[model samples]
Every structure is written in C-alpha cells, then in structure tokens.
Target: MNKQHGSHEDKAERYELKQTLSTLQLWGIAVGLVISGEYFGWSYGWAAAGTLGFVITSLFVAAMYTTFIFSFTELTTSIPHAGGPFAYARRAFGPTGGYIAGAATLVEFVFAPPAIALAIGAYLNVQFPSLDPKHAALGAYLLFMGLNIIGVAIAATFELVVTVIAIFELMVFMGVVAPGFSIANFTKGGWSGQDVFSLGAIPGIFAAIPFAIWFFLAIEGVAMAAEEAKDPKRSIPIAYVTGILTLLVLAIGVMVFAGGSGDWTTLANINDPLPKAMKFIVGDNSGWLHMLVWLGLFGLIASFHGIILGYSRQIFALARSGYLPHYFAKVHPRFKTPHRAILAGGVIGIAAIFSDEMIKIGGQTLTANIVTMAVFGAILMYIVSMLALFKLRRAEPGMERSFQAPFYPYFPAFALFGALVCMGTMIYFNPLIAAIFAGVLMLGYVYFRLTRSQRETPPQNEVFEPSEELA
Candidate 1:
C-alpha cells in the first residue's frame, strides 16, 4: 500500500505531459510555428536592401537555418528535454551557458507572439476599420492562452487545421500573383545603397539578414516540442527537414511575387503584405482580395497560437529545473498543461502589446522594434546552440545518437559564423535595440546566479526518462 502511494506521488511530481502528438501533428506545429513569417516580416528586407539585395540576403540566411536545424536535430533527439536549447547548452557549457541560451530562447519564443498578434489585429482592422488593433491583439492573447492551458492535444489539433489552411492560402496567393510576375518589376532597384559586387554592398546584405531570417525565424521551434512529440526520434528529423523546405519555397515565392507586383516599398513595412500585394496583382475589387484578407488571419493565428505552446513549455522546463519561480512549473492537474506558465506568458505578451503602442525608436513603430529585438535574442541563442553542438561532439563523442548531422564540423561552423555576422551587423545598424537586448541578458544572468541551483543535481520531482516510446 505504501509503495503504491509513493508511486502515485512520484507520478504527480513528474508533471509528465502526455505524449499525444504524432508526426503529422508535429509537422503542423513546426510549420505553423513559423508560417506567419511568410506573410509579414520578410518584406522589411526590401526596406534595407532592394528587391534583388533582399533575395541575395535570404539565400545566405536560408543556408544558416538549413545547417543549424540539421545540427540541432542531433542534440534534441539525444537530450529530448523540454528545455530545448537550454538543455543542450546546459549539458555542454554548464550553468552560465545554459542561462544565456535559456534567456535568449525566452526572448525568442515570448517576443515572437506579440508581433503575430499585432498582425492579426492589422488583418482585422482591414475588415472592420472601426476596430482598434490593440483590442483585437489582446483578445487573441486571452482566447489562445486559455486554449493552450486547456490541453496540448486540442491546441495541437487546432494548429494542424489552421496550418493546412494557411499553406493553401499561400498557394492560392502565388497562383493569383503568378501571371503578374515581371522580371523587370522584380529586379527594380534590385541593388540598394551600393553596387552588388562592391565591398560597400556587404553592409546592405548583412542588414537585410534579419528580414530574410524572418522567413525561417522560428523553424527551430520544432525542438521545443520534443517533450510532447510521440516518436521524437523518428518524427523530429522528418518534421525538421520537411518544415524548412516548405518555408524555403513559401519564402522565395512570396518575396518574388510581392517584390515584382508593385513598388515593393508600399508593402515593405506593412503587416498585411500579402493582401496589399493582391491589390497590386488583381486590383482592389477582385473577390480573391477579400477572401485573402480573411484567410490571412489563419496564418497569423497559426503562429501566435503555436508559439504560446512553445513559451509555456520553456517556462515549465525552467521552473521545474529551478531556474524560475516554482509557480510556473505547476501543471494543471485536470488538463495536465502548464496553466500557470501559459497565463504568465500571456500577461507578458499583453503588456508587450501596450508597450509597443507607447514606444517608438528612430521613427520605427513598436512592432518593428520588437521584431528586431526578437531577432537579436534568436541569433544569440543560435550562436550558443551551434557552439554547444560542436562542444558536445568533442566532449561526449559516444553519446547515443539516433540521427547525426550530415557534415561533422563544417555545417555547424558555418551556421555559427553566419549567426555571429548577423548579430554584429544588427548591432551596428540598431545600437539602441542591441543595448536593450544586452541589458536584458545581463539582468537574466544576475538572476540566474542568485537562484537556487537545479543543475548540480536532478530534483526528485523531475523525470529524466520518457514515460513511453513510440512502438
């Protein structure tokens, strides 16, 4: 009787999330997590670099993601922790490195959603001019946070449906805009600031990296779902490879069509670039225009909802490991989701919505400001993660590996260098935002030092083993 009672207590303490997600659903989460990037943020590249310059920039950024995802797959499958990069870095670099990786990841997952939420609001305002974007943004937060807290199965299912619709809409968008595609139009002002072959054009290409990165910004978010994935060893590789390819196709298609359709400048900075691009291709009165506007919301919703799942898991992992307040680690006994973490993140996102409205820098809106800020965080995390991969490869050579990155050192080294270059270029271009990001990292480190150590020894409540493996 006592043994059974102890076993029940152990299970409760584990906070073990049910592994209900299959490969298709994992693919949905991975793709949905980043599909919104195709719709909005990448256009900003045109502002920094002309149409051709942006395309050039995107090719390099694509290379980085391709290599990084391959290397990340090995660590994620072997470690298979909800902490994602935090877990991998922790294993590689001790507490300080782990904290940096975790903090950057928090910034990436947490900061990403507000931008998507704001885009959702912008899409709504297009339909109903009277509605305030902020109100719609806040409403989305509340509704989705509740859904996330309810259950991962339900939330993931919703993600799958919306992701499918969003993919279809992009296809329809490409079809509508295809005939209008003009090589001359696409190539207009293709090089901005300097000639392509000149040394001076390097800055323009580097500056455009962030916008190009928007195309695949959160694709690595697939790693965050490792804990919930049904057959992580098998499903993760398939999802990562397929997800990046899908985004690559979508990214190139959208950038070319939108760039060529009109004065790319017109849509360069707006949140609803696709709808505006539709206006240029088919004119304003086309029936497809209205449908695209409404359907575009699904793309933003897919990302916003998907990231909520990611941030909550990050929070749960940190809290469970004692890097954060224990409160955030608590799972809802009924739903078995991290209810506290979800609500806490929602509150932060709501605050970010209002803060963006109140703050502006160098004539850039709060939305642009935060998007760059999130990129700052993401690159920092990427630098650490790629290094961790190399470090672990040398340090623990015999670690069990279900999947290995194709190229040993070169792939990860290139990814690491590219991430560093992007970070340096962004800092040179946006010093103030870089300063703010640096301050946040410093403060996060200070807090980590003061916190109790969960790294030295595993907590009794933590479960290091999977509850069940895929057959």
Candidate 2:
C-alpha cells in the first residue's frame, strides 16, 4: 500500500502543468514566439536574394506556414499535449518517429532562443554603446528562464502584454517611415543584386529560404502550450488562425515599408534592421529612433521569453516519454513548471551565445548559422508532422477532432511538398549546417538504441484518447 501511494504521489508531481492559458494568452504566445523574426532575422534574406527576390521567397514561405497551421491545428486540438509534433509523431509512428520529432523540436526550440537573445543584446547595444551584446544576451537567458520557472500563468500574462506592445511598435515603425517610402528605392538592385528579375536569380531565392522562413518559423510553437490551455479545443483553433493572419499582415507591411524607405541592401546583414532603417528616415538623434531602440527590445523579449517556455515543455515531454533522463520531466512542487528542463535549455543557449565568435560556418555570423540550424529542425519536424497527420487519419478515423483541417489531403499535401522543397533547398545552400543538424540527430539515435532496454514505459497522458464528446 505504501509503495502504491508513493508511486501515485510521484506521478502527480511529475506530470502536472497548470491549465491557465486563455485564448488571448495563447494568441500572445503564438505571435510572441515568432514576432522577433520581423524585427531582425528576415532582413538577412535581402542579403541573399535582394529585396524583390526575398519578397518572392517570403510569400512562398508564408503560404507554406498558412497551410501548415491549418492542418497542424487539427492535431493539436485532437491530442492537446505539450509535446506538439512530438506527441503526434509518437502516436502515428511509435517510439522511433517520436524520437525524431522530439529531437528536431528540441533543436528548433533550443537553438532559436540564442539567436533571439543575441538580437535582444544587439538592440540593447544600440542604446548602451559600451555594453557587450553577448553579455546582455546571457543576462536575457537568465532573466527570462527565471520568469518562466515562476509559473505558467505569470509567464503567459507577461507574454500577452509584451506581444501587444511589440505589434504596436511595428505599426509605429511603418507609420513613421511612410513619408520616406519610395518604390524606386525598393526595386533598385532587388533581384539578387540585379536591377531586374530573371532565371539567374533562382539560386539566391533558394539560398534565402531559411531567412524567409524566420518570419513564421516558431508560430507553431503555440501547440506546445496547448496542454496548458483552458478549453484547448476552442482556444487552439482561434489562437492559431488569428495569430497567422496577424503575423502575415505585419511581415508584409514591415518588409515593404523598410525596403522602400532606403537602400534595402544596407538593412541586410544586421540584427538591428528596424532601428537602422528608421535612422535613415528620422536621423540618428531623433526621438523616434530612440523609441524604436527601446520598444524594439519588446519584440525580441517576447520571442526569447516565449521560446524558453516552448523548449522547456518540449524537454519535459521528451523526458517523460523515456527519450531523455527522467530528471528533466520533474515539475516543480510549488511553481508547477518544468524547472530542471528550463535550466537545461538555458545552459545550452548561454553556451551558444558564448560560442558566437568561436564557431564559424560558411562565413556567416553566429546568429545566421543558428537561425539556419533552427530552420533545418523546423522543416524536418514539419515533414514528419504532416506525415503523422496522414497516418493518424487512416489509423484512427474515429478519434474526436474538435477542429478538422480544411481541404484535408490537399492542405496537408501542399504543406508536405513545401516542407520537402525547403529542406532540399536548405541542404543545397547550407551543406555544413545540414551536416551538423544530421550529426545531432545521429548522436541522439545512438543514445536511444543503447538505452532501449532500460527505458520506462510512457505514462498514460502521453497516449491519445478520444474526447468524451465522441464517446
């Protein structure tokens, strides 16, 4: 009796995550997780493909994400687990597929924070010239992780507040830059640095795939918070559909306004593109420039803080499934957060920030390299997730689906095709980063194989069950 009671207590402590997120909070998390992309990373696409060329790439990627979220929503509402793609793949393809999906997600969530943190640092540097961006980045990791560890409700409330401000600041940026916007400036040398578009621009378009993807890269991370959502079936769909629409408008608006304001090439290859673009229109000493520098940190903060939430849930989910050390699965007794997993992800992010100068690949900055690596993970997970969607359709047709993906086969199929194309193009353009991504997966698989016998059986919550509505 004592043994059984102890086991019950352990299970309770290990699996609890407070279901406190509302639709607005979920929307906040959905948008917050990817909004930073608009502030910084996507400009690098202009470096690779020029303004018009990158515009084409962004539109294509935007289409891919639109379709992907529609299809992915069905799975989230059906499963409603913190694992997101990891849980879906596990249900459809069992342990190995789960490992692949989980590992890919870990890569995506883990690596993305460092890049955003560095951007936050860069934004801070614009205000405080003497501060080291790396040090600032490290401080960001520490501060946000503590916030996340405090509790889900607190973390999500903060996300909502900051995301709203970030969105408003972006609108402010567009309004302030509108007077200087010139079509001639936007189109000049806009096709892979050529004045006109041609078939010759194809290579640059392919090379720009990852940076273009940055715009909506982590929006799907909303799925990670589904388990913690109140009435996930109703809230997930609303948050996801609305969130994608919001991001698409902001991405196009921000990109066009910035490109048209000045020589687009100057905005490329920098972390603080919005402020720099504003400086062209407002000058170096303007209040508008200072406002952007200060408020801009909110965009980076939203993503950095939200992703820290995302990575911890993924780490906790993976560990609970016996794919990682059980220590990571522990929920804090008081806070109800995955404290260990949060800290673990933080350590990796800090290490990447420290290695910014030490590690070089393809002559890209640390931000660029990590962004590419995260994109590789995201594309792989997307492919596997769409496959899981198809598999579950056949395998469990009767499962309760609160939200069915519109267009069914067509929507998922298009998403799959786009993911495949992006993955192939990314590999062609970034062979070294692709190899490093592969190496991480291979090492993870080896560990799985070696520990197969000792692995614990997954708890009941890790498995899917039809909703009571179906019964």
Candidate 3:
C-alpha cells in the first residue's frame, strides 16, 4: 500500500504537465482570450458613445495592438510555453525580477473574474429590474466558477459556444449594417469628439489605450492553457495570429460599421447598442433577430467561463510556486483541473458581492470599483513585461529563436511604444482611481520581498522529493 501510494504520487508527477499543452488548444485558447468577459460592454460602450470619432479612434487603437500580438506570436512560437510573460521575465530578469513581473500579473488575473462576474450581475439587473442585480451576479459567478473547476476542456467547450454567439452576432451586425451604412454619417462628425481630444487628448488617449488596445486581454490564456496546446509552437503562432486578426477585424468592423450607420448620440445612448443596431436594421422582424442580439447575453456567459479558466490556472501556478497556499495547486484526480484555484476564485468573487458599490459616474450606472482595479493590474503587468522583453533581447542576445519578432528592434519597439501610450491613457482618464491601483501593486511587491520562506516558489528544475525516500 505504501509502495502503491508512492507510485500514485509519481504517476501524478508523470501527468503533472509542468509543461504540456498543444498548438491547437493554444490557438483556441488564444481566441478564447480575446473574447474576454468584459468585452461585450467595452465594445458597445465604445460604439454607442458615438465618439464616432472616438469609436474610430478606438478602432485605430485596436489596430495598433496587431504589432503587440505579432510580437507575442513571434515569442510564443519561439518560446511557446506557459508561465507567459512570467516565463519570459524570469528568463530575462532571473529570479528576483522574474518573480516580480509574474507577481504583478497575479494582480490582473486575480481581479478579472470578479470584475466580469459583477458585470454579469449588472446586466442581468438591467434586463429584469426586480432581480437584485447583485444577487443575480453572485449566483451567476458561482455557477460558472463551478463550471471552470471541471477542467479546461469543459471550460473551452462552453466558452467556444459563447464566442460563437458573440462573433455570429457581430457578423450578423456587420452584414445588416454594411448595406445600411451611410458614409455621410461617418464623415459628418468625423471630427466631432474634438473636445475630449484636446491638449490632454494624447494623455487621455494613452490612459484609454489600456482599456481599448487589448479589449480581449487574452494574453493570460497563453500561460493558463500552455499545458494543453496540441502543438504550442506551430499551433500557437497560427492561433495567435488568427485570434488577434480575427478580433481586430470583428471588433473594429462592428463599431466602425455602426458609426457609419448612425451618429454617436443615437447609437451610444441605447441600452444594448449592437442588438439595438440589429433592431434598427431588421426592425421587429428581428424579434428572431433580437435573439441574435442576445449574443451579448451568451457572450457574458462565455466571458464568465473563460475568465474562470484563466484565473484558476494563475492560481494553480501561484500555488505551485509557493506564492499561494499549496492546496490551491491541487489538480483534480480525474478532471485534471486546478480544483483548489477554482474554489479560491469563486470564494473571492462571492466575497466581493458584499462590497458591491453603486457609483454614479458615466451617467448614473452601478460599476464595480474592482473592475477598475483589475484594469490597473493588467496594465502594470504589461509594463513590467515590456521592460523584461527589452532587457532580454539585449542581455541574452544569443537565446535561441525559432520566431524572432519581425522588424527586429522596430517590431517590439512598436509594442513597447504602444503599450506605454495605452498605460498613460488609462491613468490620464482616471487619476484618483489609477493612483489607488498603483498603491496596491506597490504594497504587494513589498509584501513578497518581506516574507521569504520555504513557501517561496521553486523553479521547474527543483525536486518535490523532500523526505520522499525517507517516507
């Protein structure tokens, strides 16, 4: 029995997949990343606000991300493994800074799910007034969180359904809007949002860039599903390229298409703009078409599913690394999912329900402070990773590369340039809010350095063999 126990442990190790995913899964995972939970609103908000100029501005911003994705694809194809930016930073910065880079990302992954879950609750409340939106959000967050705990395959399958709904809705939208698109509407207010784009326009733009650039924020999926990709090298590159391009086309297309069809004043104010646009194009004949508008509804569900998967993996990685409790790293015996991490994400989300504050900002709507916090964290991680990528290129010039970032210094240079722009924009738009987020990251960084223990994350090469033979 003792021998059997040891054997079982070793077998678990065999299946541990410290590094296991394939390329196909990686690509699907990449696609899954961009169709993030918060996007349904993000894009709609960008469109309807009629900042037609701003929407176009946003499309330009979205286009700018191509450079970053290509650069990442180049890296993913070459490096093509998990730990993502954390993996990259670790290699470039060594233990100290690497750990720091990854820790910063933890802030992003950790906060994303709750932000999204909360958003779901808000939308539900909007649809059905009496539902205690917060309660609906709580229940919804818990249900999907449970789905994520099942395993990535299940999550991916569920998420694929959501992505399909979202994309189909968008595609239908494009088809409907294209014929109705009047170039006159687009050019009429081509320069309308001029007020918001003043002397502070550049700064404001930079601050907003973080919010817009990677509307998908799918980079987390690279690391989370790294272990499951079929051919991470070839598959990831294709998926990375396809996913980014697809989103870029679909995302930019819809809003730009919508802006051409109508003005910001008209489009922006409607509750569900995309669906509303469909209604405008198809009319009541679209009661069936309205069903398609429910794509955002399906999207909300999918976004919930995907974020849970990404966050759970981050938790699993953290737990395995010693940054979090060990139990969180546990893989389900049969499911092979990070059951503990799933639970942690769920509990935190549930706990957040208690703190849901309805703040009146963009015209009397209830938004979670936690959502903004998540954005701050994601930006911080990217900043550190940018520096890491820069240093790595210089410090370890000889590191093998199957896929070097195109245009050499220029390609990643573009990403670094663009990333900075976006970060600056996010901050400019929300001064007090951005400051609080920065403070939290600073606090987390300090806490980690102060608490060095056996709990410290061990490297991939380290053995878990402590007293194993003795036992």
Candidate 4:
C-alpha cells in the first residue's frame, strides 16, 4: 500500500512536469525570446544612434545579455515553476517582491508582442512597397496566432528552423562582407554635440544603449517551457547559454563585418543596412541579397511567432498559480498550447497599430515612445530579478541549484548596474520617451495593488518560505 501511494505521487508530479516543457521546446523558447528586443526590431530607429554608437551599443548589450542569460538559467533551474521571475523573487525576496517582479514581467511580456508585431510591419512595407505597415503588421500577427493555436511542437520547430536560417545568413554576411570592410566607416562621429558629457552620440551611447542589447532575448521562452522540457535542469541551462552564445557571436559578426568600415556616402544611404552590406560586398547577382532579405523576413516572422509562443506561457504560468485569469492557464486539448492567451496577445499588437501607425505626436512616433517604454519596462524587471537573486541566495542555500551565476556578485552586480545606466541614459536623452516608459510601469503597479486590495485575500493558499541561498 505504501509503495502504491508513493508511485501515485510520483506519477502526479510527472504529469505536472510534463505539462511544463521539454528540452527541444525550451530551445525554441530560447531562440524566439530575442525577436522583439533586437532581432525583430533592429532596423527601426538604430541609425539615430549612429554607426559608432550603433556598433558600440550592439557589442555592449551583447555582453549584458550573456550575463543575464547566465543569471536567469541559475534562477530558472532553482525555481522549477512556471512563474519565472515570480518564483525567483518569491524564493529570494519575500512574496511582495515576487508580486512586483511578476508585475514587471507582465508588462514586458504584454507589451513585447505589439512592439515586435509593429516592427514586422515596418520591414514588410519595404519588401512589398505597396503594403501598408499597419496591415502587414496585423497580417503577420494573425499568422503567428494561428500557428501557436495549432501547437507548441510546430511552433518550436519553426523557431529552430528560422533561427538556423538567420544564423546562416549572418554567417554569410560576415564571410562576404569581410572583404570590402572599411575600418574608417565605423568610427565616424555621429549627431555631434562637442560636450563630451552629452548624450547625443556620447550620451546617446548611454540613451541608445538599450537599443543594442539583442542577443538571445526571446530565450526567456525557455522559462515558459519549464513544464515541457524533458529534463528541466540539464536541458534548460545548456540550451539557454548555448543559444545566447550563438546569438552573441552572430551579433558581433554583423557589427564587425556588415557594419565595418565604409564611407559616410555609402553608409548614409544604407537604409536596409545588413542586406545592402551583403550586396555591396558580394555583388547582388550572387543571389545573396535575395537570400538575405528572405532570411531576415523569416527571422522577423520567427520573432513574432516567438512573442506569442513565449509570452502566452507567462499567462499560462500566472493563471495556473491563480495570479491571472484562469482562462490564460487553459491549454488546447488537441494541441496542448495556450490558445486563449495567444489570442489575448493580439490586443496589444492591434493597439500599437492604432496608437503608433495611426496617431502621431509632433509629427514623430508614438512608436518611438513605445519602443523606449518597452526598454524601460524590461529594465525594471531586470532590476527586480537581480535584487531577488541576491535575496534568493540568502534564503535558499539549501535548495538544489542546477546552474550558478558565474563570478558570484560580479556579473549580476555589473549587469544590474549596466541595466541602471541604460535606463538613466534612455530617460535623460528622452524624458518624454522615458516618462511614457515609467508611466506604463507605474500603471501596472497601481492596477495590481487595486486588484489585490479588492480581492481581500491572496491568489493562492500556497506559502513560499524563503530558502537559504542568499549571498
């Protein structure tokens, strides 16, 4: 009788874990994770950062990304729950901090889909010429929703396949563009204000800093797949770090080879930057330009797919814990994917089309404001997560850890500091932009507090006691 009861408990636990994620699926989450941050939206307004600024921003952000991936992997493995940052904060900090962490992630995950889908529209306009950016953006998002509704397995497969194509394209661009690279093109001063302290190009480096941090963003999707991974401990860390490393290499290569030395004349007209660089280096007839555009489009498509794939999981996770609407927790019976939440993501994308594509502020983008808002929101979440990590180590020393953030206080501290600097630069150069960013986060907090007060009780009966893992 005792043996049978123990077996049943094991089976129940297995079933719950099975619903989380598998290794391959986690890989999909990993690749899809960065679409909004850089891979999807890379072209939009980066030039405003200028060439030297852009290259500097890209390299600096890549380092930050690698460090954070390490941090997240450590936290994810320890928590083993669906509510990623929430679980980490709860473990490291107290429940209140956990709620705030969850709140910030909610903002990032919620806002990200639209931010990405909006980007897809911008590029599609260049491709089709006749296509409206808004329509193209909406069409792409609808397709992503459809695929996600079909299944995660399919979605993961798509993410893997597209990431492969993107990786190859980046490699080809480096291999071809390396020969023509001009060293002088990269260092040219941009948008000058001689005051070395200013944020224009120098200061812009700080303000535009967030623009450069693209490597392996969507990889947070791995956390969403926590229930789906075959061996959550081993698989998540391997895929998480490896995928981030691969992206970092590609990002750096593009910076070196594609964005390398060129005359301001050649660089000035370079709107479709990467594709134009490849064509410039290899002659368009090599059929490489077509391939570059296609690959970029595919990567962009993959990014949107990832947005739906990754963020819906957040909804599923929050819902399962009773922190969000239970409908978000529902997985399709036939597909085993979160169809309801997948559609819910559409709300933000559609809103972006209305707000940015439709309305303009001073003949400039509400879109630009949206982009800055996302960066601030993501940074806020990063801040909460890092502090939570420090707290987690103090409380959860007894918990089994699959991965540890390297250099102890070094990497996490620097990453948090970098995140702060990035945010400050962004706010300083673009306060109207920054205000929009801070406003969104404040709104979320206000909403959460109001909702919590009205409910009168916490979401779940579960009590999360602190572990001994504090630093």
**lDDT top scorer:** 2
The window of 10 residues in a row where model 1 has the poorest summed lDDT is: 462-471
When 3 and 4 are scored with TM-score, the better candidate is: 4
| Better-scoring candidate (lDDT), 2 or 4 | 2
RMSD to true structure for each model, in Å: 3.6, 3.0, 4.7, 4.7
lDDT of 4 by residue, 368-422 (tens): 4555555666777777888888877886577788789998888888778877877
TM-score quality measure for candidate 4: 0.84
lDDT for each candidate structure: 0.85, 0.92, 0.59, 0.64
Global Cα lDDT for candidate 1: 0.85
lDDT of 1 at 31: 93
After TM-score superposition, what is the CA distance of residue 445 in candidate 1 from its true location, in Å?
Answer: 1.3
Residue range 4-30, candidate 3, lDDT tens digits: 999877755633543444544555556
Model 2 scores worst on lDDT over the 10 consecutive residues at 462-471
State in Å the error of residue 244, model 3. Answer: 0.5
lDDT of 2 at 65: 94
Model 1 misplaced regions, further than 4 Å: 1-14, 197-200, 453-471
Give me candidate 1's TM-score against the actual structure. Answer: 0.95
TM-score of every model versus the real structure? 0.95, 0.97, 0.83, 0.84
Cα lDDT of model 2 by residue, 1-471, tens digit: 999999987887677688999999999999999999999999999999989899989989999999999999999999999899999998888778888999999999999999999999999999999999999999998899999999999999999999999999999999999999999989998896564434888888889999999999899899999889999999999999999999999999999999999888888999999999998899999999999999989999999999999999999988776778877888998899999999999999999989966779999999999999999999999999999999999999998999999998999999999999999999999999999999999999999887664354544344544331100
| lDDT winner between candidates 1 and 3 | 1
Return the lDDT, model 3, position 146: 74
